[model samples]
Target: MTVTVDEKRCIACGMCAYAAPEVFRIVGSASTVVAQPEGKSPRVRDAANGCPVNAIRVEG
Candidate 1:
């Protein structure tokens, strides 16, 4: 699985980073995930769902 972040929809809440620091980080004022490491999709997706603004996406 792969994850994608809709930067435009982000609210800088930092929930994703808090939920999964290894997969997500605060870049400037938004959250982002390193989606190319092969086995982090579930963590990223969980982070996304944990976001209050719903700013993340997961794709297989």
Candidate 2:
């Protein structure tokens, strides 16, 4: 799976990184995913869903 962050919608709240530090980070006022969500780990998906602005997108 792949995780993409919508910079436009990102508020730099750092929720994604907080939820899944392995998969996400706050960089230059934006949220970025450093790892791929290939396994069954729900961290990435959870972060996406937890985003208040819906800035994260996950694709398998």
Candidate 3:
């Protein structure tokens, strides 16, 4: 699976970064997508769901 964050929709609350720092990060006060971990969809989904602005998206 692949994870993406819509920079426009992101609030930079650090939810994704908190939930899955390995796949996401708060850079320059904004949420940025990092390397997607292998076989880590569930964790990514948790991060996405935790996003208050729903800025995170997961794709297969």
Candidate 4:
């Protein structure tokens, strides 16, 4: 799976990081992908869904 964050859309709310610490984190003014797991992770999906501004995207 591949995970990405849209810098323009990110608001540094930290919800993505809070939802999936292993895959996302708050860096400076945005959320970034810290690790890309080999497969689909529930936490990753949750993080994406939890993003208030819909900055997180997940693809397989």
> Which parts of model 3 have CA positions greater than 4 angstroms off?
none
Candidate 3's C-alpha lDDT? Answer: 0.85
Question: Which window of ten consecutive residues has the lowest lDDT sum in model 4?
Answer: 31-40
Cα-lDDT of candidate 1? 0.74
TM-scores of all models? Answer: 0.75, 0.89, 0.88, 0.92
Give the top-scoring candidate (TM-score). 4
lDDT of 3 at 16: 87
Q: Can you tell me which runs of candidate 2 are displaced by over 4 Å? A: none
lDDT of 2 by residue, 1-60 (tens): 788998988999998898889888899989887878667668888888899999899887
Ranking by TM-score: 4, 2, 3, 1
Give the Cα lDDT of each candidate: 0.74, 0.87, 0.85, 0.88
Residue 48 lDDT in model 4? Answer: 87
Which ten-residue region of model 1 has the weakest summed lDDT? 34-43
